[model samples]
Target: MSRIGKKPVSVPAGVTASVDGQTVKAKGPKGELSFVVNDEVLVKMEEGSIKVDPRDDSKDARSKWGMSRTMIVNILLGVKDGFEKRLEISGVGYRAAMQGKNLQLALGFSHDVLYPIPDGIQITVPRPTEIVITGIDKQQVGQVAAEIREYRGPEPYKGKGVKYAGEKIVRKEGKKK
Candidate 1:
């Protein structure tokens, strides 16, 4: 019933995967990661690949089947190659910098917004307007990026704020007499 669930996830070189009950754990050059699948979804490893299927034909089980499979695949890839997110800061005087272990943001505020870097996650400011967040755990990397972007999300008017790279913001027109 699920196309994605039907396909097996192959284990890449230099990476190891194991299945325990409803959880799949992967260890690789990047780091180690694990995903706990839903009870309705069954997970197993075979022939150096991971397989997922629904335990029943019910709607809830079917709905979690594809998602569970995808989560397993994400953990495997994350352990092998890790994940990365890029953010771009726009507008005058708006920029980002790293002070020790904290990310300092200048977003037209009265005070600089400081964000503490979390363990296992790396935050780099290659340029004043460019922020790169990298981590072996996809969820953590995305959560950190979201937190950073939340500080000053891009606005429609003038499109001035923090936004994901390659993100397009729909511009809003100004009022005229």
Candidate 2:
């Protein structure tokens, strides 16, 4: 029994949702998004809410049931309010700035790192040390942030680099003289 799959996802006001076969589509003020549920899960629109059920009483079906439901819910919310992630840069001469639609990062590298911005996603540098990523698609927003952080991951010794806001880096002691 999947506890999460048992509950239906309600279509909130101002957002429209539809389930056609295995494909679930949602449109809202933010934007429009769609998701294809797994074949092991049965998706349907019941009344004003979306319902998900396992195709069979097998372990695979049960495992995919909750996940399918969550995917539908995430898309719905994403199209309505969108998603955002914040990153902070810390290091000597380390900073970030927006070059037109692209992101320019100075993470102590020999040369500046230029990240080309993707469609439907916005990268903004509110301050030299703060980077904000926003988009209607949750996955894209997170992936873009991760790609930017990959350029210069925070080092444990100095905790200097690009990292998620509020992320704690475990410090390591240097060699004793």
Candidate 3:
């Protein structure tokens, strides 16, 4: 028995849910998303709620049951509230700006880097040094943010680079004179 699987996901207002065979589709103010229920797990729509059930107690069923439940819940939340990731530029000359449909970043490099924003994802620069990524798909939002930060990872000395907001960087001591 999976505790998470047993819980019913509440359908938010303005969100619609439908089930067809092993597939579940959810549409909300943000957008629409579809997911295939695991073979060992069963999903059903019941009175404004989505329920997940494990077929059996076999090892495989137990393993997939929790995952399927989590996926369904995330889908519901994503369609309704969406997700967001915040990034901060810490270098002296590093900055970010939105140009047309692309993000222009200056990370102390010789040349500026341009990253095209994909459909359904919004990148906003609240400040020259701050980046805000928003999207319905949590995974994609995180991936884009991580890739941007990788262009200039935080340095241990001055902690200069692009990093997640509120992230802590441990400073390394300089060599003795």
Candidate 4:
């Protein structure tokens, strides 16, 4: 009954995919990734695509059906094309740079914040105010971006902080005279 689950996830060229019981693994030009589907959902490789369905008509099974399908799609795309997230720093003395393999951030703090880069992920500082995060796993890329932004979130009054590219900040009125 899940609309998304009904559609088969096609295998793209230059990528190889396989299903082993509840686990789906994909290897592509970008890298290799795998996901273990919930038992409530059934996964199988059919023809040139992957299909997901609920094992039963229960609510739990139906709830996991679409999510399982989407997870499979993400892994396939991740291994093939990877993912990217960009962050922008805005402040009087705020900036970012790559020190060896660590990301050193100066967010108007007393001392610089050093974030150790995780394996399978790359962080680049093209400019002092711009940070680019790239990785094969979509979740990891997003998590790293969020963690970086948490260091100095944008303030509504001055809008000075680290934020995702294209993000809009809601401003508040200043003190009345």
Candidate 5:
């Protein structure tokens, strides 16, 4: 028996879960997400919980049973609570500001870099040097954050660039004299 697969996924308030053949859909306040689980994994919706059961005892079926359950659970949570990533500018004159739907970044370059924020992702500037990324889908939020951070990655010498808040950069000595 798979422990994780046997666990019951509780239905939270304002969240609805429905199983249709091989696909499962979860709807919450933030948004709605659907996942098509493996055919070998038998998913059943009970009174207020969803259960995943594998049709076979094979290794592959057992693994998929648990994996599919976890994926579906994450989608449910994501639609209910969402996800957020916070980033900060770490240079003398590096800063970020919201210009309409675009992010204006001044990263000690000759000209400011303008990054157009993607749809379904929200960018907020709590402070001049701080950036907050929020969205329902974890993958999209992370991808957008990575793209922004790549514009001016943290440097080892001066540790100047865009990075996640509280991230540590290993500073290196300029030269060996």
Candidate 6:
């Protein structure tokens, strides 16, 4: 009785979706993406919508049913509108810039950290302290942002480093006098 799996995922007007065996593919104006549903889950198209169900009543099957349905939904939405992640650098000399097809970061380091942009993903620096990552795949976009943030994560005391936009950092008290 997976509540989310019971709900069908509708294909938007401009997006096309197909389910072949365990693989679900979607194509839209943004781009194309696909997800492979687990064998424990059964997927099919019903009246322009995708439906998912567990193959059995076992715990594993039921667990995968909801996850598979969410994965299908992610691809459909990904291909339709894409995804974006924003990172902010908050140090005195920390900044980000686009160097050709790579992202150059100055996170209070002696040398600039050069991160090569991957294919199908776009990185833009609207401002020196702001980094925007966009891609058709939600996972890739999020992974790229995480990798960049790992270079110089925000500290608890001063919170001087790179962090996600609107992320709240828990500050720690400074050394007592």
> Model 6 segments beyond 4 Å from truth?
none
- How many steric clashes between backbone atoms does each model show? 0, 0, 0, 0, 0, 0
Q: Candidate 1's residue-wise lDDT over 140-164, tens digit each?
A: 9999999999999999989999999
Q: Against the unseen true structure, what C-alpha lDDT does each candidate score?
A: 0.93, 0.93, 0.89, 0.95, 0.89, 0.92
Please list all clashing residue pairs in model 6, or write none if there are none. Answer: none
In candidate 2, stretches whose alpha carbon ends up further than 4 angstroms from where it belongs are none
Model 3 spans with C-alpha error above 4 angstroms: none
Q: Which prediction has more favorable lDDT, 4 or 5?
A: 4
Error of 2 at 86 (Å): 0.2
Look at candidate 3 and tell me the lDDT of residue 17.
Answer: 87
Number of colliding residue pairs in model 6: 0
How well is each residue in 22-42 modelled by candidate 6, as lDDT tens digits? 999999999888898889999
lDDT of 3 by residue, 46-155 (tens): 88888888887798988898888788777788999999999999978899999999999999999999999988899999999999999988888999999999999899
Question: Which parts of model 4 have CA positions greater than 4 angstroms off?
Answer: none
Candidate 4: C-alpha RMSD to true structure equals 0.7
What are the per-residue Cα lDDT tens digits for candidate 5 across 79-168? 899989999888888899999989999998899999999988999999998999998877789899999999999989988899998898
User: Which ten-residue region of model 2 has the weakest summed lDDT?
Assistant: 100-109
**Candidate 2, pairs of clashing residues:** none
Please state every model's RMSD to the true fold in angstroms: 0.9, 0.9, 1.5, 0.7, 2.3, 0.8
* lDDT by residue (tens digit), candidate 4, 53-162: 99999999999999998989999999989999999999999999999989999998899999999999999999999999999999999999999999999999999999
